[model samples]
Target: MIKYHVRKDQAITEVKVSGHANYAKHGEDIVCAAVSTATILTYNALERMGFKDNLNVSVSDGFFHLEVLKPNEFLGYLLDNLEDTLHQLELQYPKYIKYQKEG
Candidate 1:
């Protein structure tokens, strides 16, 4: 199963994603692929928008952690998109994924 946590506070949003869905073999798991695609898209967008100075990130096999140190309205909106995507996935595949959001 894959588990992720999102934290939102004033001027900050931290997201951590870890583990594989294991819905199928590692290379052929659609659940994992879907999550990866969504996460990568968010990460890329943050980078392209020049949030590098206000962010901390770590990416590796089956893990991604993004910390938004100085979130603004735009960044918050973008991160909300990410949360929505993950929430949809969690709802669709309750057996394979879990999501938690906190403040």
Candidate 2:
């Protein structure tokens, strides 16, 4: 299963995603592919929005972590959108994805 954890601070937001959705074989797992695509797209969007200087991103097999070092309105919006998308995925693949929010 994939576990997504979101954290919010006064002016920073951190997202941590880990684990693989063992719903199917490696390349055949739609859940894993969806999660990976969404995460990479969000990271690219952040860079395109010029927030790369204030962001920290890490990725490895079955793991991804993103930290917004300085939060702004646009960053908040992006994070919110990411959270919503992850939540929607969780709703559909409850056994394969899990999401949690923290402050």
Candidate 1 at 28: error in angstroms? 1.3
Per-residue lDDT over 32-91 for candidate 2, one digit per residue giving the tens place of the 0 to 100 score: 999999888989999998999989999999999998887788888888888888889999
Q: Taking the tens digit of each residue's C-alpha lDDT, what string does model 1 give over 11-77?
A: 3388899999999997899999999999999888988998778889999999999998777788888
Error of 2 at 1 (Å): 0.7
Error of 2 at 9 (Å): 3.1
Q: Report lDDT (Cα) of residue 73, candidate 1.
A: 86
lDDT of 1: 0.87
